[model samples]
Each structure stands twice: as C-alpha cells, then as structure tokens.
Target: MEFNITESIQILTKTPSVISNLLKDLPETWIKTNEGVDTWSPYDVVGHLIHGEKTDWIPRALIILGENEDKAFVPFDRFAQLKNSSSRTLKQLLAEFEELRTENIQKLQALSIDEQTLERKGIHPEFGEVTLKQLLATWVVHDLGHINQITRVMAKNYKIEVGPWTKYLAILRDKK
Candidate 1:
C-alpha cells in the first residue's frame, strides 16, 4: 500500500498506549529481562523510544522541511537509554513516553503534511538524501519494529519454559 500520512498517524498515535497496555505494572523480571546479551528489555525499549521522541522524529522532520538542504541529521545514539534511563523507574519512563508521543503526534499534525511536503528532502548522516515520506514511514515502522522487539524479548523469557511449543514460536527460535 502507498504511504498515507493519515494511515501512518493512526499507528503512530496508538504506539504509546499499546506499549503501556502491554508493559505497565509488570514485574521487574518481566520489565528488565532481555533476549540475550546486548539486547534491550521492555524498559530499555521504552527509553529508546523516548530518546527518539526528543531527538529523532520531529527533529528530522523539521530538517526535511527546513531551508538547509545540506543539513544532515544528527546520528541517533542507539544505546543512550542504558545510562539515560537507568536511574528512573519503569513507571516514570512509561509516563514520559506517553507525554512525548502525544506532543510529537500533535507536532506532526501541525505540519499539515501533503503530497508535496512528503516529497521534501533531507540529508541523512549515513544514507545521504532522503524524502519526508521515507522518514515518516520509517517512524511508523520503527515503532512497530520496537514493539515487536519488546514482545520478542518478553517471549524469550518463556523460551525454555514453553518447551514443546518453542518449536512453533518463531520469536523464540534460535537464530544462530
């Protein structure tokens, strides 16, 4: 299907609530457990999403709409959540994420993005020039991917316990 700003907005707005419903008030073991080394827990995923809200999406959208065609986006810090959110409780992170997402969604709507605007270009640090559509689409997919990551990480907690069913659960299947 074609990239529709209205359709994208639908998923974008729901991400916070979807995450909150799946994660809030869970035990620390469920919140903090990772799939393996270097993987993110549900808590860490929320922080990473928060970091994106502050620095990635709208910031890059502005760059795309800005007059400076040469202005490349700042590279995102993929692991900033480890230290940035370590001291905060999962509850705090969840609440903050909700607020940030709501604000960003409002900002996105305020842009009044049209087909012409979606075609606007911005420089990406690694990928060179990219369109607003690609960025917005990525924003939607990024949320979905992370949500999948959160679920997979949660599912991995039961990998061994699932026993016979593990063979049918792709998320828990050994990738190696």
Candidate 2:
C-alpha cells in the first residue's frame, strides 16, 4: 500500500486535539472510573498512548530511520509507566499526551523522503523482519484502534448499546 504521509500526518495531527477536546468536556472524575476494571480508564488510555509515542513509537521511528533492520524491537512497560505518570490532574495528563503526539509528528515530518521509504528491518518478537512503511502504517492503525476502544469504553460505561441493526450497520460500513 502506498503510504500517504500527508494523509497520515493529518490524521496524526487531529487525533490528540480530538481526544483533548473529548476530555475537556468530560468531568475530571469520569476520566478515572471503574479503576479495577480490566480495561483502562480514559486517563490510563491516554497515558498509555503517551508512553507509547515517547518510548515505543519514537524509538521505532528512529530505528527505522537509522535502518537498523537487524535490531530487535524494544519492549515497553505501559502499565508501569501509566502508574508512575505522576499524580497530576487529568487535564495536565491530557496536555502532556498531546505534546508528545506533536513531537512525534515533528519527527515524522523531518524524515527525508528516502528515510521514510527506507526498507526497515526489525525482528519483532512474534513477527520478524518488518519494514519501515509497515511500522508506520501500524502506527496509524494503532491510533484508530485505540480511538475505537475509547468509544467502546465510553458506550459501555454509559450503559448504552447500539441495537442489533446498528451492529449490522457497522459491519456493512466496514465492508466499504
């Protein structure tokens, strides 16, 4: 698949703003509901994404740019990072997350065309020898996936379920 950097960057640019706005309207307490649930609260979710961009995402991007195909992918401890992300306010965490995302896009923009196209080689613990473009694509997909997760969590927390027909409509939408 052709990687449209412009489109990807646009998506990357909007996500944090969108997420930030979502949080801004929410009550601060809502960001940390159901603490012991298997799923993360909204705060934890954003924190995880922040940790991901700083540690996993940026490092992988650098490794790809550096053309270190033989290197192993680094593992990140997201939960631990989230726990230690400070006892700051939810708004502060949201802002920190957006700042990190902005940094990621800046780094992405600085990549030369050649660097972006370079054949990345990394040994994933499960899937080996992945390409740079593939990793970039995965990063975009990861953003959307988490947003979807957040939507689901929001719906669940509100005890609002789409009807059977709505679920069918979603499946049909995916077909397109």
Candidate 3:
C-alpha cells in the first residue's frame, strides 16, 4: 500500500481512542496482568506509548528535519515508561497520551512537509541514515504493534481457560 501521509496521520491519531476503547474501565487486575514475568501489561503498554508520544516520534522527526543527516538522533530509552509512569493512574496516562498525541500531530501538520521533505534524511544512532518517510512510517507501525501487544497480553490471561480453543487463537498459541 502507498504510504499516504493523510492516511498515516489518521492511523496515528486514532491510537489513543482505540487503546481507551479496549482498556478503559477494565479491572486493575486485568489491566495490570502480564503474559509472563518480563512482559508488559496493558497499563504498561499505555505508559510506554505515552513515553513515545513525549519523547520518540515527534522529537525524532524534528531531528530529521532540522539536522538533515548532520546530527545523529539520540538513542531512545525504550524503558522510560517504567520510571516515568510510576505515579500516574491508567486514566491519567490515557489522558496524557491523547493530549500529547494531538499536540504532536498538530506540530507535524504545521511543518508543511512536502514530498521533498519526506525524502529528507536523518542519521539514526543505531540504523544510520534514514528518510523522514521511513521514520513516519515507523511511527504508525509502532502504534499498531503496541496495540496488538496489549491485546495479546490481555488475551493470554485466558489462555489456560480457553484450553481446546487455543488452537484457533493465534494470540494464545504464540507465546514468547
């Protein structure tokens, strides 16, 4: 599929609502449950997404546009949400994610990026040079990845109970 900026933005903008619709009002036990010792819970996933909204996506885009490969983007702290989300409730995190995402999308739109700008290059600390288009595409996929992760983790709570039906459910069968 073509990477239409408008469609990408639509997917990016809808993430918070999708997350809230799936997670809001759930029991704390359910929201905080993990598939295993090291995996993230639904709450943790939301916090991690909040961290990305605050630190990763737009900041990296700005670096790409402003530096134009002159400066390498900083390595992201993938676990920032662990410390940063300690004090906030799931509701607070959701609200913050929505607000930050909206603000970032507005900033992105304000950049007035065109085809040439989308082709602009930035240095990634780990991946070396990458295009603005690649970065934006990653941002969209990143959100979807987390949404799928949250769903899988939640579903696994029923893995044992589902028993015979696990054969039909890829989420239950695919345990990492």
CA-only RMSD, every prediction? 1.2, 4.3, 1.3
lDDT per prediction? 0.92, 0.71, 0.89
Residue 136 lDDT (model 3): 96
> What is the C-alpha lDDT profile of model 1 across 1-176, one tens digit per residue?
99999999999999999999999989999999987688789999999999999999999999889887466899999899999999999899999999999999999999999999999888888898899999999999999998998898888888889899987889887451
Superposition-based RMSD of candidate 3 using all C-alpha atoms, in angstroms: 1.3
If both were scored by TM-score, which would come out higher, candidate 1 or candidate 3?
1
How far residue 14's Cα lies from its native spot in candidate 2, in Å, is: 0.9
Best candidate, TM-score: 1
On lDDT, the stronger of 1 and 3 is 1
- How far residue 4's Cα lies from its native spot in candidate 2, in Å, is 1.7
The sequence of per-residue lDDT tens digits that candidate 3 reaches over residues 1-176 is 96789999999999999999999999998899987777899999999998888788889889888845365787888888889998889999999999999999999999888999999888888889988999999999999999999999889888899889888999887765
Model 2 lDDT per residue over 1-176, tens place: 68876787898888898778777768756666632546677777787888888788668767756754457777767586457664867787778888888988898888864543757566666787787777777788888887766655555444435545555544323310
lDDT at 145 for candidate 1? Answer: 92
Error of 1 at 134 (Å): 0.2
Candidate 1 accuracy as lDDT: 0.92
User: How many clashes does the backbone of model 2 have?
Assistant: 1
